[model samples]
Target: MIFNRVSYGFAAAAAGAFLFFAPAAQAMTKIERVVSPGGIEAWLVREPSVPLIAMEFSFKGGANQDPVGKPGVAYMAAASLDEGAGDLDAKAFQARAERNAVELSFRASRDEVRGSLKVLSDRKAEGFDLLRLALTKPRFDQEPVERIRAQMLTALKRETTSPNEIGSRLWWRTAFPNHPYSLPTNGTLESVPTIVRDDLTGFVSRTLARDNLKVGVVGDIDAKTLGTVLDQVFGALPAKSDLRAVPQARPEAVGKRLEVQLDVPQTVVAFGGSGIPRKDPDFIPAFIVNHILGGGSFSSRLYNEVREKRGLAYSVYSYLLPLDAAALFMGGTQTRADKANEAVGLIEEEIKRLAENGPTEDELEKSKSYLKGSYALNFDTSTKIAGQLVQLQVDDLGIDYWERRNGLIEAVTLDDVKRVARRLLNGGVLFTVVGRTQTAASAKQGG
Candidate 1:
């Protein structure tokens, strides 16, 4: 499945070294809007320096569109797309892909059916055709279907009691009760067994179409040429998507605390509260405020108070999860089971402190400088730019967003930061803790 949402609420950011090429990357990124002969639209960034082409595209329906009592239908459908199609069986299709060195895959994310393709410039033709077939004519033969099902079943069994998985799932379920947004993107063990061939076929027919699509391409391609390829690949699909409308959802039960008992030594903690959606005017400020609160790694208040000063945990962090239907601010930490209560209490203290007193002028300036400087890394490679383009389209951020983004960050005044801090953090966050077999009482408010 398209697992851009796969990390759930607590997936830690992978540690990495910074490669700063901010100036050149900013100058080199000139996004062009490309419309095909058949009127398919795509965002293109040309990087002739690279000999490869990478494309990312998505249709707006995802695993959330899973039928009632049948979560993971879209996931199974996405995973099975390349197993077989048209004249090629699963083996033949995979062999062709391997021989051509073309990388192509599809996923069912919470909000979209997403796909990515990468190929040597010379092999792009094979790659695009393979993507077309996979999108339009998947065979979904029984053998490959059975194999993938078994693999998914194995993973589900392994994760049945996993601390992180259990805590993350619980957080979502509790936050969005009885809503499709609460359903596991991967179908549950109970739901997966009942899924049959028709569900897969039906998901493809209803969800994958031109009207709901967005495309992005980068590396060694001109707008004129990509226009033709776009039509050849996506032009044949039906113009309209047959999708059920998903309503806007808000996270429920703020300040509610729940815990699961397990034997693990480290308690896994997930906490979050109301968020300003990406489209909100306050999101950029919220983004900056969040960086100061917990998103900035070593420099954040949470890391400094809980880990740097008290040494209660090796890591602590948070993020703004603005889904298509909901806006959420979430964070997580792992610490000694005995220290879970302390870590959580400190986190609560920092959030309320920031909400009551906005970040200092120096902290605000540092966060802005860091955000502007780090943005260049987003465009350092063709793949990264392509991914960003697709996401920009998904967010409906205008074509000029890249040009305007840093300016928006620069425009946030101290007053703006304070206003958004209360907007996002004034109310306390919900908490879900796993691995503290002894009940850790609710987070106590104190300095």
Candidate 2:
């Protein structure tokens, strides 16, 4: 259910944002690979678009692999890599990267972690070397460790005060319980202080195995040269860990409604339960159903009912989150505390109605067309194509997943949508309300 893939093909940028879409006809996808002596392998795609090159390296068992008592170790390690590697301190590294117009980022999700590099095509060699150093020879110096720790602590403090963060934290804790999926990828306040440099060292040493790594290079590099680059970068890594030995996710406990009272003008409510797991046979159908239900903005039921019709909130929507082990489907909205209860009620009623009836033919058609039309946009640039490659590799989605993705979405039917909706939306749907004490009291008063 790892849903780092959750942000599907959402076009957050206008064509002008990246020099126009370059026409769908010009977009193409092909797979080529290189094998290193260390047994590390990389899949690459050559897109000679902008004078830019991008690569994504994905490692297995991101947050889920955190050892006992060191819940956030994996995430900290990912962040720390860029802080110092070899002779470059954080500042020096940033200077070098900016000087070369390189964008280097490391991010973690429940299932996998990623390190990405994007640079001018002419600077590919230097950028790749820098990335290699960060991966293979990161210098987890103590001074930067303390600085990073304090920064994270401050960020966590701010996040805890936010209503969206409050609801999400509570929901995962209730749903996953003892499971790794239950923990925040970013460590909790209490856990952050306990993570030390040695913790990071041990985690990276144990986790950065050759077989655990997969990379994709896209842009101006061809398969042969990319293979050589992959070897020089990740080729020396140790053997792969026993991947199958990883623990399986436990069944989610039935979640309960929780309300956190703060001083605020609006009440933010998140409602739903464990949805469809990523590897579940019904995942594709569940995704289609979710889009039809609330994922599609103007065309979705939640937008039409909650905003356009009643004007309850500025935004209202539902989404499915498939983690490595568990899936969560949630609908959310922010409204006046007095109207919060009514908003939650409307969301549930609509879910129940869909469970009983299913989407109409028109809704089904629109969702399909939207999904199909969006496929080409996935290859808009090297950065995006590289990212998609890493994700599909991590999911074992097969190299040809992009070629067949549209077909899968097209195969989903109205009956399939109803079946998944009915199967997923059941029991006491967990509801999380975050707002001021007065707002919580008002919502309770109406209840």
Candidate 3:
């Protein structure tokens, strides 16, 4: 899902333009911290060049907070927030948003519920008011509740037949069997219909609190003004959250392969194992090692070995997925059903090679240069800037992260990469494949 690109057209345009003209030379971003009179705090970046303002915020509770039988409560709650709020009905609220060119949206990931707002500077008051209303007084009207629930149900049904979707679902389910991470962020078909208005309301009431909130604002707003707006938007929420403590978990079913027999042309193979957490000292080194192994686009070893030389798959890559409660090294590729075993074998061989020999100096330098150059993409637009700032807060990266990031990457030596490679790549791997493969079926049956 991290790779899925949802088009916020204007936001995309701004990001694209910013990147296009960005200098190859790197520079540190200036970030300001603003604390409100009500004790609310936010990260702020002022950019008066654009008349529009973008704010991104997140709360700690997410799908992880859903009750045992209510898998998608947080997700459904996100969908219903803007449908109706305070005194406005669904249609009326939407109409008011459209009239002022305000863009408001919410999303639920495995660890957090995030919201984004974009509006013209002239309409800041209206935009802030609408957001406050949504946060504090969402109606969760029956019509909208049923409508959104139906939509999620439809998506779940569709996923049943999608190889990529099915493979991902089964991978997590198999990897974290007893943990909340095993459940789909969007509830299953059975769980979705059981969600009610009270479920949605309860999720919002318990999760949206001052203690767990992180916010970032960009464009046409000063610290003083943003401080006032922060309190106005968030001060009314409860000071504390009622979230349950999620226990730490790691991927299970390691060194095992599971197969689902779907009649798809290409087999979808999802593989992962243990990973370094964001707070770990070895994370940056692990990141550099991952880039050389698979995270780098076409230049990566996996891409070259799997796609170019052997033609086993069109794409192959891996990444470090550091969630709040768990960290993972995950990757996937699609290949002919009959070639699934061969593809998996090749991936394992490549991992072994990286673990044993590490990357060449040439590869390491190239990866470092690419990473340093692309850093500007993270701050290409007001929305993107705010989003990155909020994420930094969530990761507990210091306020000076932007300034320190490149130096951290630059300090990763060849020795460090090799050490982390052995640390991470030498672990047991879990593989989940969905397709018509005799080898896969045999593995599933313990053959």
Best by lDDT: 3
The residue-by-residue lDDT of candidate 3 on 42-161, one tens digit each, is: 998777666678899999989999988789899989888898899999889888877666778898999999998887787789889989999999999999888888888888888878
Q: CA lDDT of each candidate?
A: 0.84, 0.73, 0.85
State the weakest 10-residue window (summed lDDT) of model 2: 1-10
Q: Which candidate wins on TM-score?
A: 3
Q: Name model 2 segments beyond 4 Å from true.
A: 1-26, 36-38, 242-255, 437-447
Ranking by lDDT: 3, 1, 2
Candidate 3 or 1, higher TM-score: 3
- Predicted candidate 2 versus true structure: per-residue lDDT over 151-241, tens digit per residue: 7778788876788887777766766677776788888888999997788877777778777787877767776677678778886666765
In model 3, the worst 10-residue window by lDDT is 19-28
So what's the TM-score on candidate 3? 0.94
Pairwise TM-score winner, candidates 1 and 2: 1
lDDT (Cα, tens digit) per residue for candidate 1, span 180-229: 88888888888888999999999999999999999988877899999999
User: Whole-model lDDT, candidate 2?
Assistant: 0.73
lDDT accuracy of residue 169 in candidate 2: 77
TM-score of candidate 1 on Cα atoms, chains taken together: 0.93
Runs in model 1 deviating more than 4 A are 1-23, 26-28, 440-447
